[model samples]
Target: MKRIILIGRAECGKTTLTQALRGHKLQYHKTQAVNRHDVVIDTPGEYAENRELARALILYSYEADVIALMLSATEDYSLFSPNIAAGATRPVIGIVTQIDQENARPDRAEAWLRLAGCKMVFHVSAFTGDGIEELLTYLDASSAADENV
Candidate 1:
């Protein structure tokens, strides 16, 4: 699969999504540092929240084939600015997490991601395995395409 680096604010379910993609048991494990897996680079929420720390994400992005910007459906505001993906060297996709939440506003979150310049956005619920298969299929196809090149 194409290696992916996930970036987002704290508690946005980046870690959870990582576990889900790996088919591991879904547990609440706070990411304190960068956890490099074969296919995914799981980053701490603070890295995306602090400007200084966010540089670390850019560095890590070099090691990834794709970058994922995560947003929680319940977030009232977006941390990302418009056309943020335009600055990225790699393909940047958006993930709207926690779609199963009672107060989830997936449409609003999708709009924020689109405004941030994500050409592809996915609505996922890690707890329910929703959208997991499709995301995996996408990664698989991307990786396959890269191998062909």
Candidate 2:
């Protein structure tokens, strides 16, 4: 599997999505540091929220096959700047979480992600198992493609 690194603000569902992707029961767990899994790296929200720690994400991206920038559909604004992923050496994908929330605005989130330079964007709800399969399938295909190269 390709190792995907997830970056996002607090409560953006990186951990929840990680668990869901691994086929584990959903659990609430605070990620204080970089949580490295077999195929995922869950970073604390601070790494993306605080400018001082933002460089760490760029550094960590070196270890990942793909860099995923996540945003909650409920967020009214984007923490990521336009073209933020332009500097990444690896493929950058966007993940819009919390799409099941009543106040979710997935379209706005997707637009922000596109502005942030993601090559592809996915809207997913870890709680409802929505869009997870497609994301996983993409990951699998990406990993296989990488191996062929």
Candidate 3:
């Protein structure tokens, strides 16, 4: 699988998404620092929200095959500005989380991610295991493609 670095604001489900991908039992664990599990790099939301620490994300991105910018469907605003992914050398994608919520507005999240320059977007609910397979399949395919090159 292609390594992925997850970036987003707090409570966007980065840690939960990682657990779902790995088929682990869902538990609430606040990410206080950068964590690596196999091909997934889980980052604290503060890293993205704090300007001074945001540069660390770029450094971490270098070690990843893809940069996944996450956003909660319930969020009213995005921390990322337009074309933020343009700065990333790695392929950038978006993951819209919390779609299982009754009030989720996945379309709105997708729009923001697209505006932020995500090459593609996915809707997922970590709690329900929805869309995890497709994301993993994409990663596997991308990893294969990278190996070819």
Per-residue accuracy of model 3 over 3-74 as CA lDDT, tens digit each:
999999999999999999999999999999999999999999999999999999999999999899999999
Q: Write the per-residue lDDT of candidate 1 for residues 1-149, one digit (tens) a residue.
A: 78999999999999999999999999999999999977999999999999999999999999998899999999999999999999998888999999999999999999999999998899999999999998998888845443222
lDDT score, candidate 2, position 119: 67
Please give each candidate's TM-score: 0.95, 0.94, 0.95
| TM-score of decoy 1 | 0.95
lDDT, model 1: 0.92
Full candidate order by lDDT, most accurate first: 1, 3, 2
Clashing pairs in 3: none
lDDT of each: 0.92, 0.92, 0.92
lDDT of 2 at 122: 94
Position 59, candidate 2: lDDT = 88
Tens digit per residue, CA lDDT, model 2, 1-149: 67899999999999999999999999999999998999899999999999999989988888998899999999989999999888778888999999999999999999999999986999999999999999898888844454322
Candidate 3 segments exceeding 4 Å error: 143-149
RMSD (Cα, Å) of candidate 3?
A: 2.2
